[model samples]
Target: MTLPAPARFGIMTAPSQVDYADLLRVWREADTVPGIEHAWLFDHLLPIYGDPRGVTYEGWTLLAALAAHTRRLRLGVMVTSNRFRPPAVLAKIAATVDVVSGGRLDFGIGAGSRPDVPMARREYEAHGLPYHDGAHAVSALAEACAVIRRLWTEPEPFDFTGEHIRLAGAFGNPKPVQRPHPPVLVGGRASATLRVAAEHADVWNYPGDDVADAVRRGALLDRHCADLGRDPASITRSLVLPVSYDDPAPVRETIRRATAAGFRHLVLMLPAPYPEGVARWLADEIIGERPV
Candidate 1:
């Protein structure tokens, strides 16, 4: 059976404040927007790449709250770091979130970077101390995926015996509404990251300053999928494009270029204190056509 193109279009909710009610309102509005297939938020404790003082919210708690407020709109973290949470716990949490959202949850995982260093360095620091070895991150990620899968599909309690996480008779119930599992989306530019996605992800999210880079990275993902004997068609490609909107011409050009580059789902990352004005602008000018 031919799969329809993955749901296209989303909005990223990354704010400088930790207000659940305010964010929920924005997500509700987004759910009604025509052509928008999903909504996403970032996962981080402190600002990973910006001023340390920037306001950051807990990704899972906020997502759980979002699930309660919106009836539609697929929701998930843009990409969560592997080192932040333990694998077994993350698995159960994701399953619970999926259940809460009535199966609208998608999981995006990655090896994230710190403010001052490239993530490839593998030395992730928080509060001024080293946290994990670089090479070990991938192992943790794989183990996490394994535990989540077992939690969702395996009958009765199951055990996840891995180097980083160990589970004995862990039980998870009320399986996600999505059969088997919710879509797992992975983000990164590394070959190993791409390989991991090829093996496990239901969607591949590409981030870039421009559409061209996103397409380039997307093509790389396709190649990786081909190598792994997975159908490229099975993996949905999404892109996040930053917009300033000061110049209509440049922004339009960027959108045109991005669509041409095969970004089926494109989300714009807006700044904090997200108001109706930005949503209106994106709906009227960018998303095009009125909301549902």
Candidate 2:
């Protein structure tokens, strides 16, 4: 199996407190960075930290808008929750965005994990979305992935019966601009999640700042791929590291360690209240120095 090219960099920004105009400005500026390959938004109904009641923009809606506004940078959520939308509907949304962006969409998804805050839980309950945990959640995520792939690739209407999702006469129209659909990036390190990534993902993304943890998860993913008779190299290895604009040294070191750990794609999560010119500075100082 041939490994694809390496050293692609992305920035994952949370849509917290930023208005439409400001968000568009950030995206436009990030797009000008020479080595920045993609820009992503976090998928969260509420802020991950601080005041949970703070304003947070919807990821898919922002992505569609970004697709129209930017030309160079690939766009997607860092990982969208499977519970937020039906699998078929998610597929259609992704396909439409791919078309709008001229085939520049990376469909990142993950099993819905329970948030630590009560407000978040209330938000889920308010929307009547079940927030399952353990094996049930993993199975749902895996089934969602299967359903999405079928919707993108299968032409004839077909019934999909899975442990969690059941679809009748499902047909996805206006197939994605990207052949076989845009890259399905599965995020998580759980055994079941890795198994699903091995079977369905074009990319496997692990979060956190620890390089050792990333290495361990990558090895586990490789084992799962091997067990399933899949080429480990076929799935792009990616890591998402939260960055401190004030301290660039550690971020640089994290990039070095992630590269050594065999991650070809590195996504930096810029902290809230993103400083002016920081994205460009990182692109020029860190990502641009690496070979693509």
Candidate 3:
């Protein structure tokens, strides 16, 4: 009935190959469950799984709709691809979501997916979105974090000149409801991305299933933090684990392992077609039952 100290839980439902009605139902149900403190969606323009032409909702747009529909669960794109939109434009989009969600936005971002991942690459090519190399992507992502934060917090319009980003008189009107901006979550395990997280992220998210690898990456982040004179503990370590409907044992064990491993922010990713009362099941089964 009690969660381990400092552990926070949430859910992620990717918008690809999933119907809006189903996604809405899950979010609405999750909003009432106290065990789940936050929710997330991934960003991708095209279907990366299932049918190549399956319907895919834009993360921000779908997120805004979910924000309006849910009264509580903190929400955001798991990691908005930095290459998808200009930094200033993404800032405005995020600010609007924060306002809509009444300040429950956790701004998660990362460098775009690598060109080697065909699913990711095809989407870029299909949409005419350029896929940059790792170095360029990481550098641009760093500049993006800086520029976006300034847009959210700066009082007046200002010009910016960075190696990867430049803006003239860029300003955000009707600032986000969260003062000094929403919590910034940078997601990735790459060393360069970790360096960016050390400098800018309030929370750093590690993708995939390998817990030990994530811990190793976290150590790398700690080193990066040291180099920047930032306390390693200042950044929350987050990781995602997949949920299984047929067997809750593996998921529960993963949760236990992850929490014990010092991953305080745990996001349980639910595979769809989400079963009936899935959120309630998650609370009762996957996560320990709520306190009596």
Candidate 4:
């Protein structure tokens, strides 16, 4: 199937269970490939899979290093966890990356790990961070999103007193290179999150393989947008799917289904121990002549 207009193709190299050299290699290769328009890293304080003690590089730090090394690929953490750091501080980190990359920054964020998911839940406890209920999380996420935008664009020092977040004379210097701030990409599937996306996101990503589910969640987002008197089309739909090294057929089929479902931002997830020239191989095989 032909990709729709304004479609994009990018790679996500989850920044865990791998070394910096390996990630840099794939990103540098992707930098020169036109089919690959963006690159991503994931935020996790500990390895969520395999051994808990496996090597895991911090997302923003690694992103900064990778940004300095690569020349072209638009880059960011796939979806930064709002619970991991205060929103204002995160804004600063993201802006610095935008400067480092010469404005090639996509700010992706989410409401952090779900308390119901044990794998994600343990990361919070293990790191001595508080784990809040879903209600609290969703509300705080909204506030954090607002705070982040203010930190990125407000001209002078300001204060905020949201129920979940409070600030005093907060301000940002050396603002992001993107005039209004880098494009905000919010990732989540819940109805509450979709509402936040309707109000704040330039892109909304569904991180699963369920095409039917994506369509359903997308409809929910459309309703949310309508309720807010906003255009649903304003938020670009994104899908995050894993890449099969030995078989591109299944991935290709998923891509077709997702595009037909109105998802244009495809984030092809690459597993660890990346092979030589995998980026070029992706261009020739999976993304061949897609007009992205």
- Per-residue CA lDDT of model 1 for 1-292, tens digit only, reads 8534433667887743546667877888877776566888887666644565656777888888888788888888888877777666777788888888888898888766533454323323443434565467666676777677777777798766778888898877767778888888887766677777788888778755466667677777889888888888787777776766664455556666666655566677766666565666777777674211
Candidate 3 — which residues are off by over 4 angstroms? 1-5, 289-292
How well is each residue in 1-292 modelled by candidate 4, as lDDT tens digits? Answer: 9535756899999988888889999999999999999999999998889887898889999999999998888998989999999888999999999999999999999988877777778888888999888778889889999998999999999989989888999999889999899999999999888888999999998877788999999999999999999999889999988999999899998888888778899999999889899999999999887533
Write one digit per residue (lDDT tens) for candidate 2, span 57-136: 98998899998999999889889988789888998998899989999999999886556556556667766777776678
lDDT (0 to 1) per candidate: 0.72, 0.84, 0.92, 0.90
Ranked candidates (TM-score, high to low): 4, 3, 2, 1
* Ordering by lDDT: 3, 4, 2, 1
Span of ten consecutive residues with least summed lDDT in model 1: 119-128
On residues 110-132, what C-alpha lDDT tens digit does candidate 3 reach at each position?
Answer: 99887777887898878888888
- Deviating ranges (above 4 Å) for candidate 4: 1-6
Every model: Cα RMSD to truth: 3.6, 2.0, 2.4, 1.9
Q: Residue 290's C-alpha lDDT in candidate 1?
A: 22
TM per prediction: 0.86, 0.94, 0.97, 0.97
Angstrom error at residue 242, model 3: 0.6
User: What is the alpha-carbon lDDT of model 3 when measured against the actual structure?
Assistant: 0.92
The residue-level lDDT of candidate 1 at 135 comes to 60
